[model samples]
Target: MRELKPWLDLIFKRPGRLVVGGFLILATLLSGIALLAVSGWFITETALVGLLLAAGVAATINLYVPGGAIRFFAVSRTVFRYLERVYNHDTVLRLLTDIRVALFRRLSQASRIRRGELSGAQWLSRLTSDVDALDTLYLRLIAPAALAGLVTLAVVVLAAVLFDVGTALLVGLLLVIALLIATVGVYLRTWRLSARQSDRQEDLRTAVIEHIEGFPELTAAGRTGKHAAWLMRQAHQVTSEQAKADTRVGWHLAGSHLLVNLSAVVALWAGFALFQAGTVSGPVLVLLPIALLGLAEVYAMLPDAFGKLGATLASASRLNRDCREDKQPGTPKAAGLPPETALLAENISVKHSGYAPLFTRFNLEIESGERVGILGHSGSGKSSLADVLAGLLRHAHGSLARTDCVYLTQKTVLFEDTLRANLLLGSPEASDTELWGILEQMELAERFATEPDQLDTWLGSAGSRLSGGEARRVALARVLLNPAPLVILDEPFTGLDAETRGRVSKRMETLLEGKTVISLAHGSEALPGTDRVIYLSG
Candidate 1:
């Protein structure tokens, strides 16, 4: 419950809107109850008058006022119901937007320590499914519970005023008991089952995603059928649990309905006895039973709302844990390097969790506009060094400083978007002419010239449509667009042919002449015009 405070505050940030929406929902429910009660009384009274006239007794009854009141209630119910839905939905959507933005910001700022504990699948779940679960918390749980409470109160008050204090107390007590049996009883019984269902659902999602992404590997190994069978088994488990939960909810809801119906009967018996004693009017006696029936709407929503409580609370707890700021006490903040310095490190040591230190007491320095190449064999901490310098990995003990740097790793990452959009990631405001100029420098202009869309052409996921060398060149083009003073390239020429590698190296020399560069590769010759070369040992 405490974990849900932030979300509650956000939902009610605009108190005026929340208040208006709540009022509309209350009005809608009250009007519905009034419409049923008034219509029942009107019909009963009109029939009694007809009987009197037939019996040769003079009687006067005005149908106009009752008819108009019924009409007003019917129309008001419809109008307010629509307004409530619209306003509440709009508010929930706005809250979702704010929640997503906050979650993304927290993820972006997550320390390296926190990131090490999260896998790609877990992050995706938090961003998509977990956020979606919270989205329903407001609409399904909060709003329904609140509206039902207000309606119950209104029903009790109407009973007391038109009848007696004893009648109001009786109705109120019965409603409270019914709500408890419907909500808290159902929640207690289904809590564990709901948690299991949610966990199984996430497991199924992860399994399916992995199966699809690793299809080629599974096929090559002749194990595709095996993986598919495993996924099917998980699906069956999810379905079984869901069916059980639904069965439990159905039985509980039926019980709740029976209790509400019994309450209506009790009201009817009380009304009839009062009328026989000449203590209540005939029309008012009919209204009592009808008003009690109107309470059915309020209790109907309780089973589903409280049944989902476990899953919603679990989601809230997960988000609260993952998105919290976890800075260690007494740790100094890392600051940006001075403008004149490309990079500086003194006795820096870095190690991954539960692993030996990759490098110990390492030292390096580079002035602005220096072109340095790092030569190291496989498993010689080349990539680790690059990550440390680029601030992707934090060091345990070090005095390290560097100006902002852009890193281009061995992998070429491209989204399913236009070439223009991919390039814009490096420089959001870059012009078409500037993009074309960079592409020409990478020798990719000739390839796009054959395409109708050119820079506007869509690149498949991860640049899958482009050849290996072409994709590398496009990645390089994006890196060139970055305005960072320093650039770090880690095995950037890994898969290119000799000729293409030479061509790219020469072009890089020209484009990166005025910027500080750190090229990590097997040999210094892989990077042309290198002013200095450093070697690393495992």
Candidate 2:
């Protein structure tokens, strides 16, 4: 229901769509009534061939009116559809923005949670599948079903007045009963299937994503065949679950079609009996079936309509649970250190349930215009401290100073875009001269110089085609272009060779002149000219 609220709220947000949607509903019903009129003209004017021809002409004109109404109906439907996409897309994007912000916030605060805690597969599932689930709100059943129902109601009432009122009432009642019974049955059957399908889809998505991400590792370990088999198994499970869901939906639609046809036959038979008994005239008898035609169509369509609505509601329920469960941790206190104060962390500690403590009373202070090296063994809290200082992590116990910093993590993150675009991310207004200087500083200028397009060269998905070291250098250059007052680098020198590392270290030293730098390192090799060392031992 909560997931549905956003979509519903969107409809009411723009008053024009609501009013236009209602107008379309009325036009749809009047079109259906025009169909009945055309049929009646055929039956009543049969005695005079010439007059019947004239009535046929008049019926044609009446029928033409329905077409115009239908045109308006189509126009309104198209406009409403456009409005819905514009509104819903913007709304979902906004929600995604919030989720992204929160995810980064949690990553900063939750020290014990490694990137591995939410594996690539899990993150992919959340970003793509879980986020995609919200489509049920706008793209599925609500608007069409509501419009169809209202139009059906108006047509039914019109038919009742035009034909024998008793028979019209009886057909409407039967339709209601038929719709209610079918809807409940379809809901129960599809509910279980849809839920299972959603679960299996997530499982398959997770497995496939993980398998792809771990491809290099699996190949190196000679376990490629094993990973392939595991992926196939997940695919099989997803297919089986999807098949079951589809089968259930198909059966429900088939049964609903059968019942609707049966009801139509019964209604026609009853009308015939009334005609024979002199209770209804021939024209009126013909009118009875004409009126019931709309009901027949409605009955046929209603089951699927209701089924999809049920699926959408189920998706909404899942979204609500996820949003509620993953609420952000405690609001972090704003960093208290003065803006000009380089960087400071006083007795910062982080502890988590069911995990080893990440940091214990860790303390560090850096004056502006200083280069400091943070050295520690693997898991000695170097990366974690960098995260805390950069406002990406929150320590349970600490007072940290505020300082502008550009953080570069170990995993060189880049969008599938041109080199210039990625570098421009930090400072879009940077001049070409500044960019070339930074590239030279990172010792990545040679690669750019050799490229056919230099800075404009396309770096495909996460810079996959580039060597690990090159990707790292490019990311570093991007941060350098940003020129933050403070820079926090984690394992920045890992992938570089000896000569390149030396050049980069020298450039970093010069760049840090009169600036504060906090770098996490495995050893002092990358420290070049830093004057201070903070060793943390866990």
Candidate 3:
């Protein structure tokens, strides 16, 4: 339950939406119950009136009243059902949007090391499967269960008034047990199976993804057949467990329906005594039992939802664990610096988890409008330093200050979107002309211009459509679009040939005319124009 508190709080933010959606659902259920109960009453009344007329006994009954009620309920049932479907589905989509946005925000706030525990397949599962389970919590579980209880109470009261308190109590007791079977009993019986379904599915997903990625290697080693068979077995296991869960839910549903029928049977049996004694009319006595039967539809919604309750709890628990905020204790934040300094670091110590300190008590200060280059080989922690400066690697024990900065990490990252859309991430308000200008400086304008869609061309997954150098240039152009005072480039010229790198590097000096820039690379030749160069020993 504690695992669901944060997500529940997020859900309750739209209280008005929840209330209106619940009202629509309740209205639909009531219309359905009324339609059946009134139809049953009308049939019994008409049959009695017909028998009286046939026996030559004078009888008077208004046909118009019951007929009109039956018509009204019938029409109301369809109309409310349609309206609830439209209104509730729209609410669900909005809730999905809210939940996805919140989850992304929390993931972003988490530390990079903690976030790294999630792999590509795991991230996909969390975002789609786990988040999906929680988004439908209101529509599927909470509203239906609450309304079932309310409608049950209403039916029990009807029984008490039309029959007797003793009859009503008997009926209510059976119905309560049935409700328990549908909700709490189902949850208790199936939670362990349902709760671990997510884990099973996640494992299968990881295995399938890894298998596909390593298929060529397996084929080369003449082991592809065996590996594929293992994946099939994993998939089969997941399906088998899911089938078991469904079977349990089905059994619970059947049991609950049996108890509901027993309640209706109890009411009909008790009402006969009342009918014989003239305590109630035949039509009215028939009404209580028929209405008790209507509750079967109400309780029908509970078992399936409660059977999946364990999976929902598991999902909530995973989300809570993954999205916990990363706290850096006793690490003082960098304060405002002197006007001349663009970046300041004092007694900075940097290291990754479970390793020796990469560097200790390192100090550096760069002034405004200066270009400084730091050269370090592959294993010299240059990228970690870059992350520390960018405030992405938060565990570093130091005081660091810098103006707003844009960083081009060593690893190029681009979404599967249009080239223009990817570039606009750096400056959302950038015009086409400004974007073209940046591309021309990177020497990629001519390359993309040859394509039919040019800037609109899709980059594919992680810029897979383009060559390595082209992708690197597109990423660099994005960072260059930002108007921040400080810029950090870690291996910015990667994947480009010597000629292209020199041309782009020479062009970048003009674009970076007045900004304070820090370029990190393995050698001086890989760096852009810099006033001073610093080197680190391995």
Candidate 4:
């Protein structure tokens, strides 16, 4: 319950809509009850043809009464439903976006202060599964179920007041008690299971991503079967956990149904007794049972909604804790010093937390308008060094400061969108002409031109549709588009052929003529045009 406060606040942020949505829900529930009341009249007055006809006429009230009030209620409910969906999805996405920005910002600050935290998988989990779990909030589980429960109570109270207040109160009390017992039971059973299930699912997703990303290495080592088996084991584990959690959900549903039915039966017996005592007529007695039965169906859905809301609350709690505990260091404010020209590392060093030293007392400086090649033996901290320069890794042994730098990783990342979409990212205002020139400069105009839709061609899933070299070119194009004063390339020429590599090197040199360029390379001669070479040894 404590965990849900912040998330609840977001949903209720717009008090006007919150109130409007509340009223709309009330109308929807009342309409449903009204519709049921008409059905009851038809059922109880079957022998009276005229009365049945009158009930049918009253049923049309949904269509004609209250000056399109019925239609207004229906439309308002739908509009609120749509608004709820849009607002919730957008809010969850925004929270995730903020989290990603915060995580990266923390990583950047850690690098500045020489602290490297949060693995790629951990960060990825936060972005994907963690954010996904919060979906329960907006998916109507919280609001709709809560509204259903409240509306059910109100209907029972109204029925009691209209009929015999005592019997009505009895039915209402039974419903509330039964609902409370079932909900509490479900919460106890589902809380840990749901939370663990979410965690396992995240683990499964992380494993799948890692296995797929490392496919090449696994294949090279002739361990395809091993990797496949490992992945299968993770998948099975996740499935087993999910199945257990799903079984609990089944139990919750079944239990809720049992309580709902039991309460309806109790209400029926009470109404029959009232009819015998002459406190209620046979028709009213019969009508009470029908309404009670209808309310039971609404009751059954309550516990599951509560359980789902519990899970969502748990997820929100995790996100909140992460946000508060993992404080990101502050960057320079907008009014701070002007962007610097050169990137400087004064005796910089980094050590992994609970791991051996990755680097110690290393010093390097990249001046403005210089293309520096970084050459190092494998495990000689080459990638880590690139990470440092790129503002991805934080080291503690010395100071590293940068101005106007964009880092490109060894592994290329592209969205499942168009070439232009991936290049422009969130920059919607970027002109097509400016974008095409970048692609052309990266020697990728032919690839886009040959495609069926040109820039509109979907580069499916992390740019899987693009070849290794093509993806790199697209990534480089993104870097070029940054227009930053410094660019750090981490093994950017990895899978490219000789000719393409030569052309890329020349093009990069020309494009970044006045910018500081840091290229980490396995072979120093790869970038012959580089002004300086720093060969590092582990």
Candidate 5:
């Protein structure tokens, strides 16, 4: 329940929109109840007057008022229903955008160190299903629950005015019990099943993706069928849990409806005594019972909404946990350094959370306009060191400072946009001539020049349309375009052949002549020219 507080706050930000939407919903409900109750009253009045006239005893009746009210209620119900759907659906769209933006912003600000902990499948589930659960919180749970309580109380008040205080009190008690069964009872019974169902679905999806991705290996090992059977079992478990939740919701819904009907029956039975004692007329008695029965509509949506409340809370918990920023306080002091120092590291320790330290009391200083290379074998944390210098990651037990820098990571990341767009991210103001110049230096100009759109050509997803070496060069070119005083490259020539790497390396050295550079790789051959070289032993 506490997990929902933040999301509830987000929903309530548009208080005016929520108020209007809620008013529309409430109007729809009241009109529906009134339509039924008034029609019942009118029918009874007509019947009694008809009987009196048939017995040669004239009894006057007003047809126009009740008929007009029934017509107005019926028309108002339709108009309000249409308006609520249109307005609330629009509200839902705006809220969806708001929630997604907020989640994305939080994710962007989350610690880079912890971002690797979650898989793509888990993120997809959070963005889609978890977000979906939260955005509907107001519409499905809060608004409906509030409207039901209000309408139920109104029905009780009607009983009190038209019938007696004792009768209204009894009706209110029964309706209150019904409301509890629909909400709290449904939640208690289905909570565990509903809460974990999303996790099961995510697990199943991840497993399926992994299996498909490794299908070739499994086929060669003669174990594909067995693995698939395991996936089937997991899927069955998820489905079983979902079915159990639905069944519990159904049962609670049945019980709540039963209570509501019993309340209506009790109202009718009690109303008969009032009518015999001349406390309530025949039409008024019929009206109270009909109104009580109309409350079933209000209670009907509650059981299902509260049944999924557990899942919504679980979704909120997962989002909160996943998006937390890791802000580890530094234990080592590095307060001062020479102004010429482009980068300084003093007594810095580096490691991932929950892993052994990669570097202990490590230190380095790179002067302005000096190039340095750090070499290490695979798993030696060369990339981690690069990340620390690039400011993409924080180091524990250390303080560090560096000039503004552009970093090319070991992995090439390009969005599904134009080649021009991808490069512009590095230097947003770079013109066509500058971009083409960098592309030519990387020896990619002739390749893209043959394309229909050249720099404007779509890169496809993650630059998938380009070959490995081409994509690597494009990422490198983007970094090179940046005018930052410092540059950090992690395996910058990855996927290029020896010949291509040599040409690109020489070109990069020329283009990067004046910048302070730190290039990290597994071997010296993979590095650009450097004034000093450090070999890390791990």
Candidate 6:
């Protein structure tokens, strides 16, 4: 929860927009209340005057003023409602942007330290669904609660001026009780239900993702039906939890409505008593009930808003845990070294969280303009070594010094964007000619040249439009564009055929001529023109 301070600060940084949005919300709620009250008084007064005139009694009344005031409030309510939606939505969108940026930045920094705790599905949920839940905090919770309070205060003051201090106190007390029932009572009763529903929803999401991604494996293993049954069970569980939550929310809403109606009835009875005592005029007495009715609209949303608090807090807590870094005492820090020395490690030992040490008393060094190949068997720390050198993993004990390096992991990542746009991630200032140059170096120039749009072709989500081999080449091309002196390629040609691998390996040697390259692969034959090879075995 404390990790949320940075995001909260970012949201309130632009107080002007927040203040204006709040003012618009307040204006809309108040205008609606005023419109109903004024309409009621005008109609009652006009009817009484008409009756007096019919009895041959002259009555002096100004219809123009009340009629104009009603018109003003009616128009203002509609206009303010529209403006409030537009302005508040815009503010929410801006806040979402800031939150996403802050969350991504924090995750990027803490990923190396908290890698074990953040699985693929959990990471996806935190970045997308969890971050999105925050909008409800502003739009649904804070804004509506604020508007209800403001309207309640206005109604109490109006009641006092129209009737007496005792009437004002009664109205205020009822409104306060209604608010407490909607917020505190609903929260206390429904929070556990909301949390259960949220948990089931996440389980359903994970189950569906697994079913889709593992469809081929399940079919091959003759367990497709079993997997399908499991998915159905998860779906049923989510539906059951959702039903329970909805039932609780329905009851809470019904109770809130009853309280609001009770308040309105009490206001009406008090107004009637004042009228019989001749303390309040007929028009004012009619206005009181209508104004109370308007208040129902404000209080109606409180039950659901408060019911969502549990889920919102749960999301915040999860995101905070993922984003916050846990620094270990006495953790080894990389030493500063000369730019010409690409890497140096002495007596280094590394281990994953809750796992045995992968590298014990390991020593390695690479100079500038050197190409080194790391060959190891499965579970022999090939990829782990790359991660450590790239500063993506912290070693438990080591004296390591390295220049900045660019890493191309086993999985190729491409966005839903033009080829040029993806390439620009490596070198933002690179021009079209430079991008094409790198593509040619990676043997992908002919593939894009045949496309109708060339560099402007839209690579569908996750580069789904490209073949596996083509996507790998694009990733390699992007890596080639990076200006970092030390380049780490982890299983770069996994899906390519033997012939293609040879061509790509040769081209990589040519493209990475002046840079320090550390190629991690299963066999030394995969790396061409390797100056040296280090084989790791347990």
- List, residue by residue over 1-538, the lDDT tens digit for candidate 2: 4556744564445456444544544454444544554455444534334465667744222446545554664565466556656655564465455545544554444433444456566666655666555543332344444655665566457556654667556666655555554566767777766766676676777777777888899899999998899778878877887677667666766665565455556557776777688876555556545555554554555556555554456555544444332244433333676555677778878655466778877777677877788888887777766767776566768677656788888668989999889999889999888888888888778878899999899999999878999898889888777767888788887789888898888777677677677777888886556778878776
| TM-score for each model | 0.91, 0.78, 0.96, 0.74, 0.91, 0.93
List the lowest-lDDT window of 10 residues for candidate 3.
326-335
- Clashing residue pairs for model 5: none
Error of 5 at 405 (Å): 2.4
Predicted candidate 6 versus true structure: per-residue lDDT over 1-538, tens digit per residue: 3544566787787689889998998899989989999999999999999999999999978989999999999999999999999999999999898888888777667746585675677677777788887765667887788878888888888888887888788878878888877788888887777766676677677767777788899899999998889888878877887677667777877776676677778778888989899988889888987898888888888888888777767778778877875554222233576567778888888889889999899898788889888898889888888887777787778678887778898789999999989999888999999988888877788889999999998999999998998898888888888998888898888778899988888877777889999888888766656789988897
RMSD of each: 2.9, 5.3, 1.9, 6.3, 2.8, 2.5
lDDT of 3 at 36: 83
lDDT of each: 0.82, 0.65, 0.89, 0.67, 0.90, 0.82
In candidate 2, stretches whose alpha carbon ends up further than 4 angstroms from where it belongs are 3-116, 181-184, 211-241, 262-288, 294-335, 338-340, 431-433
Q: lDDT tens digits, residues 1-538, model 1?
A: 7877887776777678777877887888889889999999999999999999999999989979999999999999999999989998897788799889878777666665576586667777877888888876767777778888777787788878877878778877887777777788889989889877877787788788888889999999999999999899989889999899988888888887776777777777788888899988899988977887887887788888788787777777788898775554222233665557788888999788789998999998898999888999988888877877877677778778877788887668878888899888889989999999898887888789789999999889888888887888788788889998889998878667888788878877778877999988888666656789998988
lDDT for 206 in candidate 3 is: 78
Name the regions of candidate 6 deviating beyond 4 angstroms. Answer: 1-7, 112-119, 220-230, 326-335
* Quality of model 1 by C-alpha lDDT: 0.82
The candidate that achieves the highest TM-score relative to the unseen native structure: 3
Provide the lowest-lDDT 10-residue window in model 4: 329-338
lDDT per residue (tens digit) for residues 1-538 in model 4: 7776665565555566455555555565565555555456454555454565667854222323433543554566566656656665655566455445654554444443233244467567765666666544533455556676787677677667656677667777767766664567667777887777666666677777787888899899999898789879888887887677667767767766665566567667877777688887655666655666666555566566556555566666766655442244322112322254377776877665677887777777666777888888778888877776665656657776767577788778888988888888624566888788788887898778888998889999889998988898898888877877777888887778899888877776667777888888788655536888888876
Question: Lowest-scoring 10 consecutive residues by lDDT in candidate 1?
Answer: 325-334
Which candidate would rank higher by TM-score, 3 or 4? 3
Model 3 TM-score relative to the real fold? 0.96
Candidate 2 displacement at residue 488 in angstroms: 1.1
Candidate 3, position 446, lDDT: 91
Query: Candidate 3 — number of clashing residue pairs?
Result: 0
- Decoy 1 TM-score against native: 0.91
